[model samples]
Target: MAKMQRNTVLVVLSFFAIYFIWGSTYLWNKIAVTELPAFMLAGIRFVIAGSLIFIISKILGFSLKITKQQFKNTILAGFLFLTFGNGVVVWALKFVDSGFAALEVSAQPLVVLLMMRVFQGKKIQPMSIVGVILGITGIFLLVGQKEIIAQDGAILGMVLIFVCMLSWSYGSLFVGNADLPKNFFVNTGYQMLTSGISLLIISTLFGEQWISPIDWSIPVITSMLLLIIFGSIVTFTAFNYLLRIVSPEKVATSSYVNPIIAMILGWYFLNEDITAQSAIASVVLLTGVYFINTKKSLTIFSRFSGKRIPKDPVG
Candidate 1:
């Protein structure tokens, strides 16, 4: 009984960290950008974080041996995670605010659902289709206004951001499908190292200036450190820990929790200027997400609530 209770407590704590701390990362991203160029900052942050994890793994007696195929997949995963997923978010900040970027990026699960059908021939529920329609419609409204349309040239940035999200979705799918290393810690460390280095090399090619030394301030450095330490390491560690101890359904639910925190923090800290449209879109997005992810369960819930539920794994 005591062991069971302890396990439950750890699971709750893990969920809390994912829900709140991860949500706040968008605000952190906004602040960090004040001092660092997106890609350069990403490169430095992930590289250091990855190196620390790798070194720690070595000290902990983790095996570094990996099959050639595993190494190749890791690099591909790295590209998706750091390059497309994170890289797009970094670059988009120049054209769109971090809060919006966060909202936009939060739509990853939706993109994944659609992509699964197209790429893997997986079945998608009808509710999922409607939920996606509502979700995508909301996004289109957010980005298609006169003022917003003026930012259309930033459509390139938008496209990059979506591509990044798709990359993350695909990488996540691959991680679950691949021949993961004997030690997950070893695999994670290698992935992070690859991702970090990939960012550094790519950023350099794009001429992301590495030395913005003049712009560094206490807040900037602090935010960068937080991302490197807490966002990448602590939260990630907690997430993996949860996966080890719980059902994926229980662990996977964090996808729903992160965005609410992101939305609240974005408004509170970044002053991302949420309007009526944004608010409506957010509500609709949330509704769609709730229905989409819980469609099967909510079909049951609707019986209890005497109301219809919308659709799975929404943004």
Candidate 2:
């Protein structure tokens, strides 16, 4: 009974780590990019975080051995997820609000579902169709907001974030079938390092200028450290653990809750407004996510009707 209780506590904590910490990363990325270049910021973050994790994994006696196929897959996953997925997000933050970015990312599960169906001939549940409809409607509402539409480059920024979501979804789906290292920590560390190096190369190709003697101000340093320690290392560790222990549906709940937490934080700390439209959109989007995850197949069109789809592996 005691062991079961401990496991329950760990699961709950893991959920909190991914939900809140991952969501909060948007804010930190926004702050970090204010003084640093986009890809450079991401490169620094992943390199440092990956180095620390690599050291810790060695200390913990986890073997770092990886096969050639594993290395190739890891590089591909890293480019899709961290280099393009997260790196584009960081670049887009120059124009968009952190809360809005979080809300946009809340649509990732739907994106992943569609990608699987398109690329792998996977079937979607009827409820998933309903979910996709609602999710798209919510996105339209969010994107059509007058405040957002009025801003220069806001729509473009949004388009880039959606691309980020697509890249991440593709990486998530692809990595599941690829041969990765058995140790989650080691696997994640390799992905981060690969992504970091790739981003650095991209940054150079673009001729991104470095802010010599980085600001090192309190908020800048604090956000960078938080992202490295909590965002990359701790939250990712928790996320990997949850994938091993729980149903994917339960773990995917983070996609719903994370945006809410991010919105709250952005409002409280950065004073980013959460308008009525945004609030409504968030509710609609989360409702869609809930339907998708729960496998509630609402029959809409005869053409769209199908058996329930299996849960996807965690991205």
Candidate 3:
């Protein structure tokens, strides 16, 4: 009974961490990059966070050694998720609002479904097809707002965020299947370290300006620290734990709520504007997400290739 209670409490706490902490990361990233170069900022953040976690994990008696295949998978996953997925989105946020970027990334489940179907030959559920269509339509409506359409470079930025979403979905799928270190913290630390180094190399190759003696203003420093400690360590650890205990589809439900948290934070803290189209689109997109993640609701069409594909309610 005590174990059950403890499990329930941990689950609830992990949900809170992933929902609120990951949601707030968008705003923090926006603030941090306002004064820092994107790649350098991200590189430093991850490296420091990874190093700290590595040391803490070691102190906690977690083994740092892993198989060669594990190392390779971790490096590939890191580059895909952190370097291209997160680093590019941080860069793109210079031209895009934090809330909008969150909305764009909220389509990750749809992208993941496509990746599984195309690469792994997984069968697509009938409702998943409808969800994808609705998701695309929601994106069109969301991006049609005057605020986004009028901004310079908004189109390119939005495209980059979408690319980021694709990379993240692929990475998430890969990591979900790959065998890694038994220790989750150890695996995450290596991922961060590898991606951080890769990002720094890319920054150097691209001739990104390096600011010496970074201006440690309260906001910038606070944002960086928050990202390192809460965003990287606590929230990510919680997310990984959730993935262990729940189905990936259920774990992804956090994406539906993240945009709402991000939009609210962006509005309250950064004074970012939200239009009617975006508001409507949020509802539509989350509805689509619900459809994609939920299983076996209402069957409409199922007799293709002698298989019965379940159609679920839009709820």
TM-score of each: 0.84, 0.90, 0.89
For model 2, what is the error of residue 221's alpha carbon versus the real structure, in angstroms, after optimal superposition? 0.7
Question: Which residue pairs come into collision in candidate 3?
Answer: 298-311
lDDT of 2 by residue, 144-213 (tens): 8998878898988899999888887787666666687877799889998999899889999999996653
Error of model 1, residue 59, in angstroms: 3.6
Off by over 4 Å in 2: 1-6, 295-315
| C-alpha lDDT (0 to 100) for residue 162 of candidate 1 | 77
Ranking by lDDT: 2, 3, 1
Please write out the lDDT profile of model 3 over residues 1-315, one tens digit for every residue.
011223778989998988888888999999988988899888988899889989999899999999999999889978887888889999988998898888878877777778777876777788888888888888989888876778998988888888887887676556656777767789889988998899899899989988764556789899989999998888888776776665455556787888999999999999999888999999988888788876452121111111111110000
Q: Give the clashing residue pairs of candidate 2, or none.
A: 127-297, 127-298
Maximum-TM-score candidate: 2
Counting clashing residue pairs in each candidate, in order, gives: 6, 2, 1
lDDT (Cα, tens digit) per residue for candidate 1, span 79-128: 77775577657766667666566666666667766766677676667777
Model 3, runs deviating above 4 Å: 1-5, 246-250, 296-315
